[model samples]
Target: KAVICETPLGCFGQTICYDLRFPHLYRKLSQAGAQILVVPAAFTKKTGEAHWHVLNRARAIENGAFVVAPCAVGKVEGGGESYGYSLIINPWGEILADAGSDSGLINANIDLEEVNSARMRIPSLRHDKSFQF
Candidate 1:
């Protein structure tokens, strides 16, 4: 299930690490009027390297919402290392900030208005159709 919280910044959609793989969750959040989707993840280095950026970008592009992903870095307690490439992407799927493989704070100036702008430009959300086979 997807949860949404209203904040001073905008309506934020929350999801944890592995949940990022599911697109339906993001669509639910976006349809519920989320302007920003927040993903706090501790993804394995291998999987992160392969799918992190692309998945995050796809979520932002498809939903016309900003994606704020803060990923863990360094070795985990049990074993393997965590990938640390935190990213702040806009609704247009442009990466505004990246925290490259290190534990540090990354910031980006986000304009909430851009959410509306991107949605207006591509209006895919308004065109959604459901069919069963």
Candidate 2:
């Protein structure tokens, strides 16, 4: 992963919709020096509306990393409507941009430098380790 660190973290961490439910993976990636995560999802409106944005933000805040989720909007042929709320959240739980209730590219011009700064300010990423209790 560090080999392509200059390529931008957002471009590489794109995962399926269900992957967001797993926070440990993000934690490991963050500890390995990942600063941002990308999730491309096509969740059913019923579920997306209930949990999508909140979960996305939660993951960002918990792992102290940025999250960019680009979700499919509109109704699919065989499925119900998809909740379209693409988001770009910062480490401090700030929503840089949110794509709410519509379909289009929600562009966010974030300072990639913030990731390191945020980590330094909080310094949580540098403190992770396995523990037994």
* Clash total of candidate 1: 0
Relative to the true structure, candidate 2 has a C-alpha RMSD (angstroms) of 2.8
Highest TM-score among the candidates is held by which one? Answer: 1
Give one digit per residue, the lDDT tens place, for model 1 in 1-133: 6799998889999999888999889988999999999999998899999999999999999999999999999999989999999999999999999999999999999899999999999998898778899
TM-score of 1: 0.97
Best-matching candidate per lDDT: 1
TM-score of each: 0.97, 0.84
Prediction 2 TM-score vs. true? 0.84
- Cα displacement (angstroms), candidate 1, residue 100, comes to 0.5
Lowest summed lDDT across 10 adjacent residues in model 2 is found at: 1-10
Full-model lDDT for every candidate:
0.95, 0.77
Model 2 whole-model lDDT (C-alpha atoms) = 0.77
